[model samples]
Structure formats: structure tokens, C-alpha cells
Target chain A: MSKLISCYRGAVDAWECDQMGHMNVQFYMAKGSEAFAHLQNALGLDPARIRKEKRGLRFKSLRTQYKSEVHAGSALHGIAGIRKLDGDVIHGFIQLFETAFDRLSAVYEFTALYTNLQTDEALPLPGDLRDRALALADDHPDIYQPAPFVGTVMPARPLKHMFESSRSSVDVWECDIFNHIEHRHIVGYFSDAATHIMGSVGLTRHTVRSRNLGSAALDYYSEFHAPIKMSTPVLLKSGLMGAKGKIFRFGHHLFDLDSGEIAISTTVLGCYFDMTARKSVPLPEEYANFPAEKVLAKQL
Target chain B: MSGYVESYRGQVLASECDLLGHMNIQFYISRLSQAIWNMCYFVGMAPEEIKGSKRALATVHQDSNYLSELMAGDIIHMETAVLKASTKTITFRHRLINSATGDPALTNISTVAYMDLTARKAIPLTEAMKIKVNELMVDAEDEA
Candidate 1:
């Protein structure tokens, strides 16, 4: 039998759709968060065990690729499997598919490490947990694996010229039982920050609407350096990484206000599309006109 | 017998849990609410048709038994089967199972009807719809 385990099944609700008429990126992350729970259970980290032990798997890094769009009322299901285990870190993948067409919708490639729920400290995987994960690890030659992310990836250190895109404090309702912010809400911050990032480059909401254009992230790569806890004031600094042809890359550095430490670094690759046609279009003139010295890609 | 098909499979979110430290009752109903659409699709009423014709299944009554508590980060899924189908209504059962323990978290019996949205009245099932729903019927004893 295939080592892949079924993880998520559900349909997209109308409210989950954005102006582009497809499920928003945040909701995609939400479904992925659900699938991640199942992945943990498969590794013997059931809810009861995690609650009793106060420890569980925390993401070290994750990459998501939006393959196809699913709209309101479209049914979706997901399957996940371990790709490999490297010492204390476990690498895995999850794919969500459109049930009706049996076509790929999104893919999540992630690496996680055992962590203390309260302290956000990385811990060595227990013997039993390690064995369970090692047993499930497979190089599944049949499954699809994304190629190495093209262009530059965000580094852990803060880069110059990045400007604040979002400022918010974590709310109790947005946290998991561990008091750490959940994955979906973390991505939601990125989603909301998109508008501000665009505004910094002269592509404000009014400008995009007037142009009848919408933006979509084709790929996103995020690296977690520290845990973002409840009620913590956080700020996201973003800068244009590069822009050419139909694609533009933006980079983000999420920092904790109290410690002033960069908590997460993310690189987003995306493009603008005609809202009516839903097809990719060339980057706006402003993208080409942005000062090259200010682009983070230059710093990288 | 292929009488029960997988309907809803997902995880329990922390926000869905109440002060009791378990998934709240409304979320259980919410999941079953989604399952109804899936179950309806298996019973010959596709979501597309429902959206296009403005004719869809609306649960008029349901009986629920919360067999176990599902905590945050727990994975669960539902296996649903048609219990009864008639000209005016369809009765189905969904057994929501905890994935790790393989135990039922909630068992829900829902009776829904195909209704005309504009008229707001229950409608009869066509002959084809009857055959599909009948194909999925399970004797009450068959339910686990």
C-alpha cells in the first residue's frame, strides 16, 4: 500500500473566495493547517499526547505552490506523505486536488522539528516518535515534487530597503492551543500585507481596480526562525525582490516588536492577471520603473 | 457493500473548541452541514445542479449524539450512508471518526429535502435520483 495518507476533504465556500473568484491564499493555508494536524497524528503526535506532553512538531520551513484555482462550491481533498527524515527534522509534502476533475490544486512541501509548545525551543525527537517518522519516510518516486525554488530565497538576516507592510498584534482567537499563532493566520498576515506592499510600489487598490487587474502568488517560501506568540506585536517588512516579464518577486521579513528579532522570512513569486480573463499579464510599468538600488534582489 | 463513502475528512481547530477544551457543538453541526452537500452529490444531486437550478437539499431535522470529545489539533473524518430515501425527503447518517483512535466522535442522522428556493417547498425526487439514493442505503444494523 502507498505510504501516502488521506488528510483533508471539503468544499470551498463562497465567502472564502476573493474578488478574483477563486479561493484566497489564506484559506488554502487554512486547509493546509488542517492537513498538517493529520500529518502530526500519523507521526504518533495525537492531540491527547501533545496536550499531555506539551510538545509537538513545529514548522521550520515550508513552501507552497498554487497549481490551479478552485472556486466556490468546488470540492477538494488532500493526501500527504513523508519525503524523508534528516536527523531531527522531517521533510514531508501535501497535495490538494480538485475532486471533480482530479487535478492538482496546490502543493505544500515542509520541514518540521520537534519543539516545546510553551518555550518554542527545539527538542530532540523521542525514540518512539523518531522511529515512527523514520518508518513512514519514503522517496516516493511516483509522487510529484517541486523543483528547487527558482530565483533567490529569503535569508534569516534582515535585508535593507524592506519597509513595514503590516503591523498587528496576535489575538487570542488567532492562536492554537499552544498559544503560538497558527499557520493559517500567519499566512493571512502575508495576504493582508500584499495590499500595502503593492501600495509602496504605486499599485494601490484603487490603481489595480482601475486597471481591472488582480494579483496571485504562484509560489511562496517561508522560513521560521522563532515562534510568534499570542498578543505579541508584530510587523512585516517587505521589498520588491525583482520584476520581469509577467512575474514579480517580493520578499518579507516578519519581526517581533518586543525582542526586535526577525521571526520569519518569506519570498513570494507572483504575477498580475486580468480580473475578467483570469490570465497572467505583463508587470505594470511601475514595477519596471522602481529604483533598482532599492530592490531587495540587488541586496541579495 | 460500498454503502458508506467518505464524506468529510479534516482536523479540529483550536478556535472551534469551547471552554470545555473540546470542539464546540456548532462546529459539529457545521461539518455535518458540509457533509450534507457531499452526501447529496452521491445521491444524484450535484452541487452544480443545486446552484444552477436553485434546488438543493435542506436539512429539516437531525439527531446527534456526541460520543466523544475531540480536542484541538485532532484529525477526524466522516463516513456517511443513506439511511432512507423517499419521494419527498432523504434521511442519512454520518459517523464522524477520530482518525488517530478510529473512534466515532459524533453520530448524526439528518433528514433533508430537495426544495425549490423560490417556492420554499419540498420537492419529489426523480426516478434517477431514487435509484442512486437506493444504491447507498444501509440497514440500520450496518451502521457502525
Candidate 2:
């Protein structure tokens, strides 16, 4: 196996933390994106060459897992290695570590397609570039582990039982220059639905304060299927997937109301907590009897 | 399956976009957080009730997929529904759509647990509140 190479080194910024008091998920993506660019450079696919050739890489899919929390002032670095190459596509892996304690903080796996910018068509890597990429290809088991739901193929079957949880129109503030919705907002949409669902079950701030309890997410996985444009009417559908002990899982589907196509799929894992004790706890009687199987039966 | 209820509406601002010129992922989550509050209020668990009861929902995990892109100046709306409600936690799904194209820009799924701010422990929904919550469940027979 080829050796891993350093791709990015930086410090966590104070501004990156969210209300939950840890680094927000978007910053993790930003860091991984930068590392991917550096890895491309290491493979000799520099910006100048790509610009001259009118060729570039487009992200086809991404999977990330937050293993540990990083606080502001935490020095961080990323190491990357090529995993596989097939024709015009490249699969890569990156590992992020906090330098202070030298602990793994997160992992990212991504697939990118080489494309002719002018024609927007997939193209194979040049012979020389392919050789260079292969020279650096490695799958270090100690440094990387497969994240759940990364390889799960979305079923093509149509949704049977779905609830329209939230409906919203795109706003100018939510779009990037490419006129596409930003990644952070996609997560925002999911969060909105989660809040509504929790409220529907009396798990609101009012109830929490009265009960001395709280909630927190343990992990997440998402898959992108299509692209959406500005000012499009969107629909989101959701259902229960399953549960194990204190952990519960849920699924969501995003649709473009205009095209009537499924655009995105997402899953989340979460846990209950005791605020005073600051530890995970069991479900209360009121919430313990949810018909998980009934809900799962309705999932697309 | 619950029917969708209109939860929140807003316009995207230019400031929310990243260097790629698309909306930043964090903003999407922030807006959804706002919508959750709106839905809570609509369901009779307004801020006043929260303040009086000292209970709140805290997200434990959230997953999102960006299917389409939305640019600045796009008017966005969000709809939310309950996916599951268990003893300690509940899951929700949200959809964001662009008004001009009438297409879904993104979809999100999130799970949260009820919390007691003072004790910081997981709690159960009251029997009375559970009955009210059942009202939010979608009628499985209804088609989208």
C-alpha cells in the first residue's frame, strides 16, 4: 500500500462551533473539501493544468462520520489516500485528527468524477496522472474504517406511506453562486422536521425544562440523488427506520415538487440524555412504546 | 403518515452562501431550527409554555441530503411531520422547496429527545400531551 500524505493542517476556529457547543458539521465538510483539493495537487492535478485542459473533478457522493468532538483552539490535521480509481471516477478517503491529543475526530469518504468542463462529460484520467494516483493509493485499515450507510444503494421503489413534514420555498440567501442550494441548508431542512416531530411527541423545551432531560444526535448519513434549482417548491417525507436499546434511527426523503423526483435521502441516529448527570439514559415510559415496526413498514 | 402542515417561510440572503456561491449547509439547519419553533407554537407548545414548563427538545442526531441547488434570492418554504415517537425520543422529517422552480432543494431527517433543563435528564411525554401529539400523525390512507 502507498503511504498516506498530509493534505491539510489547521486549527479549529471559535466561530465554527454551534449552539451545541462543538464544531458544526459544515466546517467538517469544508475542511475535508480543502484536503481533497490538496490531495489532487499531490497527484499532480493542479488548478493551472485543469484550467488549461478545461477538465475538473465533480463530487458525486460524500459520506462523513463524526467520531469525536473538537473544540475551538484545537489544532487539527488531515491525511488522505486514494482508495480506488475506475475510468473517470476516483474514490478517496480522509482522516481528521486533533493534534492536541492526537485523537481521530472524523472520517470522510468521497467519490469524484473527472469531467470535461466545457461539455460537462465524464473523462478518464490521463495516463501519467493515473500512474501518479495509483502510486499514492492505499487503504490503511488502522487509519480508516468504513462508515455505515456509505455503500447502501437507495431502492428505486416509490414511497408507499410518507408524511409531508415541512414545505418551504428557496430564498436568495440559501443559494450559492452556482444557483444551487447549499449543503448546510439541506441539513437545516432535516433539523426543522426533527423539531416538529419532537414537538408532536411533547418533547419540546417546555417539557424538557419541566422534566430535567435532553436529547442529542449520535451520528448521521445522507445520500444526494439529484440537483435542484432556485425558487423551487420542495417536499420532505419521513418515517421511523428502527431502534436498538437507547438508540433510535429515522429516515427522510426530499423531493422536488415540480419535477416529482426524489432528490435526497437521509438517516439519523440519536440518543436520550440526563442533563444533570450528563450521561445517556433509558427512554421514559411515555416514549418507550412507539410503534417502530409500524412506522418502518411505511418507509420507502 | 401525517399530513404536511406549512411551518415556516423566508427568503435566502446573499450572506448565507459560501465561496462556491451556493447556500451554506449551516444556514439550512438554522432556518429549520426556526421552523421547528414555529411548528411547536402552532401545536400549542409556544415559547410561553416552554418557559412555564421548563422543558425543551434537543437534537441528538441529524442527517441531510442535498438533491438540488438553490441560489440567493430564492424564496424557500419548509414543511415538517413526525416520523416516530418513542419513550425518550422522536424523529422528524423536513422538506425545503424553491418557489420559482417548485422543486425540492433538500431533505432532512432528525431525531431528538425531551430534556429537563434543570436535571439534564431524558423524560417522557405526558399522557395528555401524547393525545395532542397523536393529532399530528398523518392519516396513512391519504396520498401525497
Candidate 3:
């Protein structure tokens, strides 16, 4: 009951930080995930063995709480412990800490299911696997409810921009190893479309230096009420959620157009960048010259 | 090794391809990683051996490009060549190959650095390790 894995340490790189000089939220989870994978290998339960043994675990949901910002150049460490194991479900607690100063920066708790790798459905853990996991859970017993932003489906809001053309499908090549579309791909879709829209407004990347500030995403969240098979057409719906001064929040939903179901919902917290001073800049006055209603009516 | 150790393999599964099947993207990386790890062990950098020396190769930057589709039952071979070596970094270029017909599957480049986990930063590679790696590099090149 006293098995405690040593902490996994990873240094924050310059590329991992955003323009805001803070570690990007997506990267924070990425670091934890890296540690988790290594931990599995250390447990003698690497993926190949799992595949060959016909047993695997899939992440069902995660609740992450951002306690403090981790700036670039910080040495980040993660301490993971099994919190609870119920039948086929294992809940884990991971704390991201600044190792140099010993300060807690972020906490992530995840719900995962033991399943047949070939079937992707919740299944009972193999007797030996369950025994090992139970031993770990018993040693560390601090269990808490997952955070709000983890697994909950995002609200489906209507689009604010009025655009006539819609993109029906995304190229298959853009999908990353996760089978789920990569996070950057989602941003790429809108960023590319934004450039075109900005063209109508007579703006270019060189003309206006804008930057993404912060973003929140639910990796496993699907808007579709039903299963979405891969390679199926995923229709995207984009809209402006709100804007205040220079700060704007945008919402996006990717759905199965044929099934009329949602596949992914994303909320972006971003701002216009001055690019010169490298500071947050307000939305340029040039935007006022464009037809706000036309640009903000339908999903862009 | 001063020169890279050349090894080759193909991709039989990819992340998005799992959408139609049961495998996930994580597994794809995991399998490729195993192949690489096994090769490294064959070259004398097994985890236990590295742990005995209180040193390990830590991954710093890894970027993967998926070029072609890999379906189940496809045979993929990976060829790895050391690109450069320094006190801290070991750069390798890996090519994924299709063994059935012999074609490229994917290309990935990874930069790993020698790390002292206790201190947690880049450190110099041991001279003995360097000599052994170079020996393996010579053997691999000679075989090629």
C-alpha cells in the first residue's frame, strides 16, 4: 500500500510558451501525458504488451485546474498516483509542480477505462492488471471529483458571423496519431479562413500582427450525441462568442453534417497583437470600416 | 556513434487510421517507440544499463510527419541514422518503410539529449558510451 513512483521532471521549452509568456494550456497537458506514457512503460505494462495481451486503457475524461502560470525556462515536474480503481475504471491524480521552487502549478485528474484495444469499449481488467492497479490505489488514497473543464461537453452556441460558403470536409492527412484531429489542425482551419475573411476586409498577416493569447479545449469532447466514425465528413461551424475592447472569445463546433451531430467544440481566448512592442494590442479601427453585421452574422 | 546507425521499418497503423478500426493514435507512437527502443538496446543503451551509469537519453524535441497510410497487416521497417552528436544532444533521422513492397511510410526526426535526472539538465555523454556507439555505427555502416 506504499508504492509511490518518483516524480517525473520535464523542463519547459521556449516553443511551449505562447506569446503571453506563459506555458500554453495544451502543452501543459502534453507534458503530463508524456510522463504518463513513461510511467506505463516503467510499470512493465507498455503498449506492445497491452496490445499483445489484448488489454488497454483509454482516457475517458480529465479535469484540469490551472493554479498558476508556468513561464518558459521553468523546470516542471509531475507526481502521479493512483487515486481509485473501480472494476475497469482507474482514476489518476497528477500534480504539475515547479521543481526548482517546489511550487504547485497545475493539477489534473483523469478518468480512464480498461478496455479491449481492438474494441475501444469499457471492459473488465485482466485479473493480474486489476490486482496491480488495486495495490497502487490502496497505497495512495486521495481521491477528488474531476474538475469542470475535463469531460463535460461544451455548450453549442450559434455562430455570430454570416458567411455563405462552408467547408464540408477536412483532409485525412491532417489527422495526428491520436485518431482525433490534432488541436493545431482545428486552429489551422479557422486561421486559414480568417485570413481569407481578412482579405475581404483588406488585411493581411503582414499588415496586422495578431496573436493567439490563450485557449481552452476538451480533447475527448464530442458534440455528436452518437458515435462519429473516422473518415466521415466532419462539418465545422465557427462563430464569434463575444468581444470586449481588444479581447475576443471565439467558439467553434465540428459536427457530422450527414448525421447532424457535433464532433468537437472549441473555445478560443485570444487578442490582437501589436507585434511591435510584443504586447497585447486592441482590435484595429480598420475592423469598424468593414460590415460588422455581415461578418458577424453567420458562422465564419 | 559519430556516424548514424541505419535501421529501417514500415508503418502498419497510424493515429487517424484508427478511426475506422480499434487502435488509437497513442498506440502508433508507442509501437514505433518500442521498435526504436529495442534497436537502442541492441546497440547497448538498454534502460537498465543506462540506469546503472546514472544517465539516460531524454527526448527533447520530436516531430513526426505522416506521409502515407499504414493499414493492419502492412509490414513497416524503420531505418535510423545518427545525424549529429555533441556533449548533450543526439540527433537521429528515422525513415519508416513498407516491407511488403518496399516503399516509404513515414519520416520522423528526433533530438535527444543526455540528462542527469537528479540535476535535470543537459550533460555530457560518457566517453565509454561514445566509443561503443561509434563501434556500433561502424559495424552498421560496414554491413550496409
Best by TM-score: 1
By TM-score: ranked, best first: 1, 2, 3
Per-residue lDDT of candidate 1, residues A13-127 (tens digit): 7788887778999999999988888888888998789989999998999999999888876778899999898989999999999776788999999999999998888999999
**Whose lDDT is greatest here?**
1
First chain of model 3: TM-score? 0.59
Q: Which stretches of candidate 1 lie over 4 Å from their true place?
A: B50-55, B115-128, B141-144
Compose the digit string of candidate 2's lDDT tens values, residues A1-300: 347866655555558775555677767765665566567666776544654776656566766767777765455667888887867678788888875467889887777777665665667788877897778776666676775563233343445544677898776656644455666677668766876655544467677657766555656666666665578788887655655578666667788889888888776776667766757777545455665444554443
The recovered share of true contacts, given per candidate in order, is 0.56, 0.07, 0.04
Model 2 residue A254 CA deviation (Å) reads 2.3
Pairs that clash in candidate 1: none
Evaluated at residue B98, the lDDT of candidate 2 is 62
- Model 3: what is its DockQ? 0.06
lDDT for model 1, please. Answer: 0.88
| Chain B alone vs. reference chain B, TM-score for every model | 0.93, 0.85, 0.68
Q: Is the docking of candidate 2 incorrect, acceptable, medium or high quality?
A: incorrect
